[model samples]
Structures are given as structure tokens and as C-alpha cells.
Target: MKAVYINELGGTDVLTHGDRPEPEISPGEVLLRVHASALNHLDLNLRASNCRRFPHILGCDLAGEVVQISPDAGTDLKVGDRVLVDNRVKCGGINLCEHCASGNDQWCARQQRIGVDRDGGHADYVVAPAINAYTIPDAMPFTEAAALPIAAHTAWHCLITQAQLQPWDDVLVQAAGSGVGSMGIQIAKMMGCRVITTAGSDWKLDEAKKLGADAVINYRETASISQAVREMTDGKGVDVVFDCVGADVWEENMLCLKPQGRLVITGVTSGSRSSIDLSILQGRPLHLIGSGGRSRRSMADVMKMVNQGALHGIVGRTFPMAGVAEAHQAMHDRDFFGKLVIEH
Candidate 1:
């Protein structure tokens, strides 16, 4: 099978597009004929970070067809089933552990990310646990289905599960051009929230407004985003702030939140190190929550909405599987909005 893999950790220079052996399925696993895979910032980090193995395939969001099922796999899925492979890998096998049993597999102590801790879907063929593959509607395109696993699920977990966004609540989403941020804006709007989002360029801000952001802030043009947000909200800050920009926007995020507001953070794309002023927390009584992967149930709920047309796929660009290096470079340069996908 042809695959994009990294033999050593570095930049795009280390990425190799060549043939590799097709992965074989284990008990409770199935072979997936990957049709499309989406790139996330995590792919970049993994490419540069130390890994336990060489020749690692980096991609988590995958849309594929089941080509082979293990005899021991207990599933109704058969060959030719179109499915979206969930990126979160549970600890125990098909027999669920306590965490996975409760739909909290993200917290499973032995859990691993598909692309990060194991070989992922950046190839023509990959293997996944049967339970990790969710069937998609026949009407959905593989490109769009490939875009949903990580960003959409993360946004749903952050805003709905963690932040508890309320209807008509004023919300601020940082980095509106990002996968999660773009999804956050749409989800908040769908939930009846007044969504305000920030981006570096006017073009991205305009695009964000089209994605349902009620107010758009061009951070590059604005000297103080918090002040701008305050002005937009008539002195009362937003009830919730969904920020993944990390240290670069941490202080501003604090300033943009209303008293007792919730701030849900899922990533630190702009460096993680930051200094917090304890006085602001004492004064405002803010809620700071950190989140990561969502549960399978959460992904199902979001997908149901997507299938129903309540939520839309946000695919910004598509690259052939061999052009993954270029896709990685674009993501690193922040040159696109929403998700970047690799078609197999």
C-alpha cells in the first residue's frame, strides 16, 4: 500500500511518500481502505516530536470503507461499509474497560491517539478497532466525513460538554480560522448563542462570519481584542470563551470573559507557557476547563446533526495523499481555514 510516513522526526523533509506493507487486522480489528484523511495540528507536532517507532503514519481523521473484518470482531459491519474511524483508541479490546464502558474512553489510562501513539490513516490501507469505526450516511462525501472525527468532536466536547454553553449566551471563540474554532463558532450559533470569533486576517474573519460568527475580530488590526470584545458586548464580556490559542491569548481570554464565565481550552497551538494573574481569578471567579478528545457518544451526536444538515463540514483544502508534505506546510503557515484533507 502507498503511504505517507516519517522515518525520522523533523520537518516535512522527513515525510516519505512511498509503498509500505498493508496492515493486517488483529482480533476485534478490521482492515479499512482509507479513502480520505484529514490533517490536524497534532500531525505537525507528532512529525517533529520523538516517537517510539520510525516509519510512522500521521493522520487521525479518516473516512474509509471496510474491506476485511477479523473473525473475532463482534460487529454488524461487513466489507464495503463506509465508516469514519474514531481517532481515540480505548485501553481494553472489544471488551470495554470501565472508562470506555461509561463513554469516557478519553480518560482510559492505556488509551492512545490513532496517529500519535499508533500508525494512523495516512495511507491507502489501515487497521482500526471495530468499535472505533462509525458508519456514515451514504449521502456524505468521504472528504467531509474525513473532516469530522477530530475537530468537530473536539468542538462539541469543549463547548457543549465542558463549557455548558447556553442558548442566547454571548460566546467568544479564539482562532476562528482553525478547525476547532470554526466548528465552535458554528456549534455555538446552532445552539442559539451569539458567537464572536477572532482571526488574524480580514479574509478569515469574513469567512468566519459566513460560518455563523455574529462578530469577527481581526487580531492583527486590533491592538486590544479584549477591549474590542467588551465594546461589542456593551461592556459585559462573553459568557463563555473557547480558546485554544494558549499563552498568546491567555490574558486576553481572561479579559474577554464575563464574571463567573467559563473558558474551555482544548489546545495550545500558540505555545503553552503562560503566566496567570491570580488577582483576576479572585475578582471574577472564572472557570477554567481543559479538554481533549470527546467520547464516542459525543461524536455520534455531532455526526447525527451533521447527517441531518444542522452542522456543515468545514473542509478548506484537499491534497492528494502524496501531497501530504505540502498540506503539512500549509497548516504550519496557517494558510487555510477549517480542515485540510488528504485524499487517498
Candidate 2:
């Protein structure tokens, strides 16, 4: 099987596209003929490992067909079924000791992830536990279904499960142009929150608005993020703040939260070193949350929305599997408004 993998932790040059051995599937596993996959910032982080066989495949989110299923598994479905993968993999499917049973036969006692830790969908084939997949509508296209897993799941986890965002609450979503950010806008709107988003450019802010952001900010234009957020919320700050742009914007994310408001964090795309003030913890009583992907239940719920046409993955560019390096460059450029999809 041909796939993209990091030979070492370094520049995009280390990501080579070529043939590798097919995955060795175990009992109860479903082997998918990957039709399409999307890129995420995790792809770059995985390459930092400098491992020879770091990622057998490169994506967490995938949509394709069930080419083969282990017969050893009990009957539930059959071959050729259209599906999308649930990127989250933890013990008991929810709120369990994740690391003890994550990513494999064993669980993650710490509740880890699948595509971020195991072989993923960035190839012609991938193997996952059957429990991690959901059926898409028969009318859904692999290209569209391919885009949902990670971003959608992560968004659902932050905006729904963790933050418990309420209707009419104000929200501030950083990096509004990102794949996660794009879905985040919709998720907040769907939850009835008046969302404010920050992108690097004016055009992306427009795209954010089209996706349902009530207010958009070009972070480059606004020197003070917290102040802009305060202005957007009528100086009261927001009920929730979802931040993925780490380190460089960490302090600002904290400053934007309202008194007793919650701030949920996932990725730290920028450098992770940042300063914080403890006084704000006591003064404002902000809820700082560190969140991972959705639970199996939440992933399924989000997928249900996709199947019902209530949710859509934002894909701005498509690249062939062979051009994984080019895709990395685009992600670094950080200009695209949605996701960069890789077709098999």
C-alpha cells in the first residue's frame, strides 16, 4: 500500500509518498479502501517523532467503503458499506481510563486517540475497530464524508460536551479559518450561540460569516484580541472561548473569557511557551478546559448530523495522495479557509 509517512522529525521533506506494506488487521477490525482523507495539524506533530515507521497512514478522518471485514467478528454489517471513521478511541467508549484501552486491544489509561497515535486513513487502506465507524447516508460522497471525523468530532467535544455551550451565549473561536474553526462556527451557531471568530485575513472572516459567525476579526488588524472580543460581546466578554492557536495567543484567549466563563483548548499549533497570570483565576473565575476529541457517543451524534445534512465539512482544496508534501506547505501557509483533502 502506498502512503505518506515521516522518516524523521523535521521539515516537510521527510514526508515521503510511496508504497509500504499493507496493515496487519486483527480480529473484529474493518479494513477500509480509503477513498478520501483530510489533513490536520496533527500530521505535522506526528512527523516530529523522527520514527522510521511513525505513521503507517497519515489521517484520522476518513470516508470510504468496507472492502473487507474479519469474518471472525459477529455479523452486524457487510462489505461495500459506506462509512466514516470516528477518530476517538478510548476504553468503555466514554469517560473511562483512556490510556488503559486506547488505540488497540488495550485501552488508553489516559484516553488517547487513533489516527493521532495509530495507523490512519492517509493511504489507500486503513484498519480500525468496527466500533469506531458510523454509516453515512447512501447518497453521501466519499469526498464529503472524508472531511468530517477529526474537526467535527473535536468541535463537538469542545462546544458541546466539555463547554456545554448554551443557546444565545457568546463564543469566541480563534483561528476561525482552520478546518476545526470552520466547523466550530457552525457548531456554535447550531447550539444557538452568537459566535465571534478570528482569522488571519478579511476574506476568511467573510467565509466565517457565511458559515454563521456573528462577528469576525482579522487578528492581524486588531492588535488587541481580548479587547476586540470584549467589544464584540458588548464589553461583557463571551460565555465560551475555543482556542486552537496556542502559545502565541494563549494569554489573549484567557483574557477574552468572561467572568465565570469557560475556555476550552485543543491544539497548540504555535509554540507552547506562554505566560499566564494566576490573579485572573481568582478575580474572574474563568473555567480553563483542556479537551480532546469526541467520545464514541459524541462522535456518533455528530455523524448523525452529517447524515441528516445538518453538518458539513469545509473543504477548500483537494490534493492527490502523492502530494502530501505540498499539502503540508499549504497548512503552514495557513491561508486556506477550510480543509485540504487528500484523495486516494
lDDT of 1 by residue, 1-344 (tens): 89899999898999999988989898889999999999998888888886667878888889999999999888999899999988887765557778777767767766887887889999999899898888888888999889888888999999998888899789999999899998999899999999999999999999998888899889999999999999999999999999989999999999999998899999899999999988999899899999965777787788788878877668999999879999999999998989999988
In lDDT terms, how accurate is model 2?
Answer: 0.80
Number of the top-ranking candidate, with lDDT as the measure: 1
lDDT of 1 at 324: 94
**Residue-level lDDT tens digits of model 2 in 1-344:** 88876656788787778887888667767888889888888777676662345544567778888888877755376898998887665554334563434533233455445566677787888887787768888887787787788888888888898899899789999988888888889999988889999988899998888998888888888889999988877788988989888898888887898888899988888877877877777688888898843456677689878888889878888889888889889988887978888988
How many clashes in candidate 2? 17
RMSD of 1: 1.5
- Assess candidate 1 and give its TM-score to the true structure: 0.96
